[model samples]
Target chain A: MRLITLPILMLSMFSVSTFAEEHVVSQKNKSFSENKISINVGDTVHFLNKDPFFHNIFSLSDEQYFDLGSYPKDESRSVVFDTPGEIEVECAIHSKMFLLIEVKKSEDN
Target chain B: MKTLLFYFTLLVSQLSYAAETEPTDYTFIAGHPSLQQWLLPTPIPTPKDNPLTAEKVSLGKMLFFDPRLSGDNNMSCATCHNPMLGWSDNLTVARGYKSKALTRATPLIINLAYNNLQMWDGRIKTLEEQALAPMEAELEMHADLSQKIALLSGIDGYVTAFDNAFPDQGVNTKTMAMAIASFERTLISNNSRFDTWVKGDKSALTADEISGFKLFVDPVKGNCAVCHSPPNFTDDGFHNIGLASFGHDNPDLGRYNQRRLNLMKGAFKTPTLRDIALSAPFFHDGSAQTLSDVVEHYSEGGKVKTNLSPNFTANTLTPEEIASIVSFLNALTSPHKPFTLPTLPQ
Candidate 1:
């Protein structure tokens, strides 16, 4: 059957290039066990600091603004969430840490 | 005095050190309160999700001295911050909103509770995002924050001060910039006379302001505590002291426009000489209009050296040590309260 329809169209383009959207964003009880979230638009989000001290995530928000400039303690950083709406992220050396991502909209035609 | 305001709020909540280097000098001694050996802790930048109240600091001091939040009700925010001139606006440029001038000038909200960043090109890092950068700038105070919150939600005395100030997240623009940033976080400064001579009070200052506070902590004389440090003088950091004298011609990379690094070219924000002899024509383009021309532009270390700020040029004082570091920076100025003005909500 034509080699099983070309191996089911190459396994649907390898499951849309292994889609992503991860999270952890902690700095130890400084809040953000998901202050707000939603992802899909080429997903990717990871901040993991889990306090022992050292963090700086930063954002000027209008839909994604970066400034990771200093991270230490169980290290991590990804951020692909490709713009959509309602961002509001933070850390800038812990002014009480914060979060809010929500990307959505990318179900492939 | 309540055991000296409980040892000065346990010296500004344990300015505990070891965040590495940077804590230059001045404060925490005599009846000890732990300015953590001269200030550092800062990290309670309050975001465990924006918490701060007192009916959002009394509706952010009536939207910081209302004037219909500007667009020609004739400016407010104490018309360029004027808690009797210590909140700065002694002007060197600032005017606009049709009065016209602005190249930069008008800063001083007092000890921004330990500044991590905000303006003079630190590009807003909260004060509820630096109170909407002078009302949607078109040259300051242009006002249009969603038609000034739909004309202050059709005023009925701002609908009872927005129903006793946010009775559950009311009247928008992020709760009117977190209620004028919770009345600019209680505009804190902590009593001066160099904090009653750092609390020992040996006749609080005057011995040439205690040899200009021992040559402002002599690091080779008036090293001005390596960037106006201690008990909040300012190490809120950012340099490039050279003021590129009034003509400007290129290079204001400051804090490298949010750190692109290049020794933060012609950097800005290092203010806080605390109520700095009443915020007069100083740098960030006010071009040092006198504190002996900003101690002769740091005694000549800034006249432009293409990318200066190696602790900004021309050192080795002596005019009796720049008049004892300008009489110990006029004892770090600050005290002028009595407000009153506001009254527009009708």
Candidate 2:
């Protein structure tokens, strides 16, 4: 019975460790699909450009700074949040395109 | 027969409703509720970092009117952005320091508070950043900010004003910019006949003007609303509207210089149509002499099609429709009122 329980515990731990989440944020009609979102640290955000024009998504936030340079429609760029803090994201070309992400420390961490 | 009639009525009603609400198929019906979004909100947007105050406005007004801000101590901001000429110099292109002609026209300061980006190229992000640009530029105001601060610090009136505006911040370049930007924010326009028409006033515009508004929104017609969006009459986006100057050799690559994007080549920021009638000699190159000329330019789909905006296309508007659109533009200008110049501190 002890041997059986150890195998089950190992399988559960393996599954949990492999489960990193990804969120898709679309740039549609010159606006972000979600203005604000909350995610756990280590979660990756994929920014998909859905508009006809080119979009450059970037964040100058102290918590995480990244510039996903201009890409045409249907293209995407992603970034992983390693730090637990809020990040203000915006499009470099379209000034009005703005988004906020609040990253919390993961339970696993 | 009765069932068929009912279905037709339902279909017509749904189409009308969609046309009213959807910007994609925008249609202008008198006193439509959907048009109210064009009215400028009463509360202006100010950054959390630089919250507006009465002291800041007062100080900013003084700084804006002071020619001493310039290196030569002659030209003030008001020299080019004259309040009498719709906050523009009424020139084909702005004459900079020592009467040197600049490439671009002096954009009107009307409804700038609503703009997401500033300048013809959308280079400056905020008014605070824009306020000091002309003052520091060699061809423009040509003043050394540190030297200007020292001069202002020497003046007792300026020192007291700066102290009141930015307590403990003292007389510095940052405080001066904040103050000037604060004053500039007060230059807003939302009380036009067009605004009144949007606010459910059926009698605000004439029948011709109303017809012109329809053409303005129609995608196949003038389609002016595509770029000259409602409320402030600007999308705050850059576009190469196909001016003749764009065809020239080594033309000014407006937004391209900043972004280096192929689409941005020769593109300039879309100026607000609010009080546009007063800010004559229009376009980034100051090519269009009148509103009629501007309409014709759009109707022709631009002279230089090298990098024309996707929104701009050859429009087949009749002469009457052109006149009507021009008439509609006239309704955008608010009725003039007396403006008292700010008194400069000695």
Candidate 3:
């Protein structure tokens, strides 16, 4: 009974890691699926390139600004959210394609 | 039977090719009409009220070149928008009729057909409306409409053209703007190496040039497409790409001056990078001189931050890569331009 319970605890821990790990903001169908996303400061937001070509994930907004310059099709990038507040993400290639990420302050941090 | 099937497939493919060969309805592409393209969302639509006419366009062309429309002989609409200088005088700040009042001036006409709103502030709605500002502005063309109209009416050529162009409105400001704008409409740029490349011509660009184009369009490399987008090559949206002057003691609060939208504090309309190599000194102020300098500016992000453009991230572009991007920009120039330099009517 003890062994079975230990295995169950480990499985639950694995599931929890999968949930809170790098959250993907995919580029698909010509726009970001969800324009606004919420995440804790420590969590990473992965810019997953699901488009046919490439995408430049960059921003000028003060909350968070970094250009993950062009990544090819099917490539993915992860940025640990060190900064908190409203971060604007945009494709350098597709001007109209823009997104806002609300980076919440991590209670632990 | 197999040969017959192959022939049928060939015939179908040829027919589809023919259908696709029909020129796009985008006016920025010379012969094509601009009603369909521009920045996709901000397409310029003729007021369900004002459709196009060939005669109106012809008349507008004549009016655009005529200096009699100005209050002072020192300036005409063409004075600032000279064809020789890519329709812009290449000044950081435009001079008045006597080169006095220093105001920023951009190109005369770009993808106007696609713009839902006109001018930096989006104040003017129609070409006809935009036509009056220069003539009436104290420091611009500086002309009173009453005298200009009388002068125009006396000219037999102008009278005849106006009579033919607008049976009801004649050569009033609206008709005049319409005619001039129609003429401007004809000044679309196409047939660049980039256009050829887009149409599947493999030999249109060199290796470096192609890579530069890729960088311009790619999200990671140059990321220029965010504002200077494709097809007609303009987004018609506003951004504050951190131009240095924004942080000045007296800051120009760009679009925010109008709407007061927080994000628009230093935001200004995104200029098309199409034919960028030909149009000197980038930005609304005509500040940056060379294309490489322009790239370097973006690479370092914007110079100032007072009301900095939210899109301003320091785009990292290398020197050799910058040269290649410049070459690619040159490739966007139209091989065959529509309008020729007019011998100014003395």
Candidate 4:
């Protein structure tokens, strides 16, 4: 029973590492690098601030809600998309910056 | 000789037109590429749906100055946003709805055409969206939209004017807002001393004002450009600059009202400093009476440090530096143009 549990845990870890991917969206010139992007569920998106000032990126979408408190240049914050839907992201500081993310159901699911 | 005289006369007319319509040459700031961002783009941005037109501007001007639109028939858009008062009321807080003191100061509408968002807390997205807010607010204009529409429609002059401006739209709320926004778009303030300097005029700014500009952009010194950025002298961003009023119990939660986040608790929109000198009594609360007072507040970081904007920091600017910064701000004022009062449709 212990041997069977260990194999199952190892298989789950391998599956996550293989299926999940990461994407980077840069914040520069008071705008997001990508206006819209598509990624599978369970994938992570890193919001990198490339501007000189600070930016507070937040999303109140029902799919994935998050508030990445203001961070300065070269810093980055990330979030995992667990649900399959659209998420609209915006900067609390600069209203001009906006981003939309489409999370599709993973093929494995 | 007759043909030569005609050609010479045509040349003079063409030259005058070129002088008025030509784009500014930004080669003067070539030494500092960073300062290039300070130049405002010409032919002001306008929304696609609400394009500017002479008829619309004329109708909007009349509506903006006509007091009959208000509930008491005493207040117009120009009452609080007086052209003589730097497009603002010049009060600590606005007097709204029968001389009642408002919670916030009347913000100047100058150069709002360049803003991506509107209002102190950034609740509205466009000038068109914000045009009727004061009229709708109970503490403000307190005008019934249905009644105002009926009143305007009853006037034969207004009816013709609206038809001319909006074609098929008539005298409706949407057409009224679009017309007002079209006129507001014409309130451009890009011809300041700083603009002249950027346009290759070396004598536009004084020596001390130049030094002030340097300190204003330096991160360790005045550091004002972090939020009050270039072009329009605004980043179109929001920040909580730590005013003393933020410490009061049940203090105003500015941007947090729209976007619920800890960082936005006291955040307010960063206003354009294009005509900074003209619009006296600074900040949303109108606490700073002078530019010197404003510099002092920034030097001390802020009056209330809690929930302060991450972009702001304590500076060690000397008295001379502060004075110089204030001098630089004084140069931001554009020469006022004569505003003609529009005749209202009776």
Q: What is the lDDT of residue B154 in candidate 2?
A: 95
Q: Which ten residues in a row have the lowest lDDT in candidate 2 chain B?
A: B10-19
Candidate 3, residues A39-95: lDDT per residue as tens digits? 887777767665545566777778766768566544556687778888888764444
Model 4: residues with Cα > 4 Å off, grouped in runs: A1-16, B1-34
In candidate 1, what are the lDDT values of residues B1-346, reduced to their tens digit?
A: 4333333332332233224233333343443453333332343345545576676777778878887777886787778887776777788867868789876787777767567677776678878878877876878888888998888888887667767777756687888887787678677666667666665765766777667666666556666665665546665656666666522666456567665544555577777776577777777777777776777667666676766544443566777778867776777664566666546566
Q: List the residue pairs that clash in candidate 2.
A: none
Q: What's the true lDDT of residue B304 in model 1?
A: 69
The whole-model C-alpha lDDT of candidate 3 against the native structure comes to 0.65
Q: lDDT tens digits, residues A1-109, model 4?
A: 3345335433534444544676778787889989999989988787877676789999999878999998876566779899999999999988888999999997734
RMSD of 1: 23.4
User: Where is model 3 more than 4 Å wrong at Cα?
Assistant: A1-109, B1-48, B338-346
Residue-level lDDT of model 3, residues B141-260, one tens digit each, is: 888888887778777878778888888677676777777777765655666777666555668778888778667766567767655655566555666777776767766666656544
Residues B252-280 of candidate 4: C-alpha lDDT, one tens digit per residue: 89999999999899889999988878877
lDDT of 2 at B113: 82
lDDT (Cα, tens digit) per residue for candidate 2, span A1-109:
3345335434533343344566678887679999999988987777876664567687878899888866765556779899999999987556578899999987734
Q: What is the TM-score of chain B in candidate 3?
A: 0.82
Model 2 achieves a DockQ score of 0.07
Error of 4 at B95 (Å): 0.8
